[model samples]
Target: MSDPQHSNGWRRFWHRGTWWKALLLVVGYWLVYQLIGLGTSALFHDVIDVADPLSSPASIFFGVALPILLSGLLLIVLAASLGWARGLFRRESLPGRRWMWLAVLLVLIPIVLRLIGTRWSAYAVATVLAILALGLCVGFAEELLTRGFVVNILRSGGYGERAVLVLSASYFAIMHAGNALQGQPLSTVLGTVVYTFGFGALMYLSLRVTGRLVWAILLHAATDPTTILATGGIDAHNAATAGTSGLIGVAGIFSFVYVAFALVAIFLVTNRTKVAPVAPATSD
Candidate 1:
């Protein structure tokens, strides 16, 4: 016979429901991320010699990579503890052909354009490796937390797919506000948030079409290093204050492209028709 104590524990757990679980997950991840950031700043303040934390390679490694790695691991552990690990990697069936192509275009076009127009530099091999590692960690942590965990939990909580997509994207975009604390100009930070909102939407559509996180993660990983290399590394102060007019112009153009693509993706995903069940054969 089942123990009454075990039964009571199970019942209490279910009583929390998906809404509470999602809220807890979001808040918990945010707190963990902030704590790591604070702790790292305290530990590394005297050790690192960089003037700006955002642009420094060592600072990026410690500030961005360490926190992201720890928070991401914690998120995964929490998800597993809550019995949601099995579905974390599950992919939906292939989306319609047109939507599939659109998804591909969404992921590829920006990356290709950025790669082509941006100039490559001759940074030391070690620096390049470190930047790549930073990119990988950012992609993995952000995607897992926002797209993987948050999206799945919301869906399970009876939220519509469209709502889930928008929510996840918005959250991803807003999280960039932390960049402001790193010394990026207010205008630059705002522009980035807008661009990222659109990027986040595209990532959502990519997951829907591919039914997996690998493509999303790869695209994300590629995007960061490409931007940094192309733009000549992360210079928050210069990007914000120096050549302000030119920066605004470039940001405007990029923002327009991102918003346009994001709208198209949203339309396609929302309007997609469900496959109808086939009628059974009738023997006369």
Candidate 2:
């Protein structure tokens, strides 16, 4: 293989992180993720049912979690190849917006509520374990791509904080557009796109408020299983959903907060720039 550090190579182009380059990176990653998903599904076809990945805990483990794990490993390679592994995990070079905590709070409240309402025993022991793994992988894969890599690129390119938030979140939303190819209904795909846009913004803020990528990773990881176990659905479909009676019924109300904050945060988010600068790893 050719060296990644070659200035004229595609790897160098991605490290420079211009808007168009970021867009191309998104496309490349989407294609790779899809290809990986197809290969994984084929390899595990005897065990996994793509029609309803959430059909059972085992199907989820084999179908959903396993593919995500592979994809995340690929992402780790990309981060290392781009020489971004260190800087991507470090504190934000730009100062964080304190008010963004409200957005994160909005995201977290529902998860906490749903956890209260979730019927723990409804899932098999192995299934819960699998979901946790899936959530962590999803968090790592998604956040590293959008927040870690893309945000670092934009920052290195000297884009303003607001532009970073908008672009990163938009990229995150587009990441979900692949679902349509999987036979998900158009409505479901569109709805998820919108919801993910909002979720993405908050996660960006999570990175901001916490001053590190790890917080966003944890938050994103926590969200998947909470949603899966709470609603008993992966994506827009729920098969074995259990009845919920308390605060969980109202949890859906908090779901709207994501889109709401996404709409407002652009105007509200700004870099305070009060922190001392930390040197980046190779312009990331």
Maximum-TM-score candidate: 2
Candidate 2 lDDT, tens digit per residue, 1-284?
44445643655666555677666777788898778878887888887876767666677767887777787788787766666667678777665667878867887898888788887878877778878888998998888888887777776566777888898999888989988987889998998898899999899888888889999999999998888888877774254564375666687776577888788988887743233222223443
Best by lDDT: 2
Each prediction's Cα lDDT score?
A: 0.64, 0.77
Candidate 2: segments with Cα more than 4 A from true spot: 1-11, 237-239, 243-246, 271-284
TM-score of each: 0.76, 0.89
C-alpha positional error of residue 243 in candidate 2 after TM-score superposition, expressed in Å: 4.2
**lDDT tens string, model 1, 26-145?**
666777788887898789776444564445568667865778778878866755554445556656543533555575575566556655554334455565676688778878888887
Alpha-carbon RMSD, candidate 2 = 3.4
**Each candidate: RMSD to true structure?**
7.5, 3.4
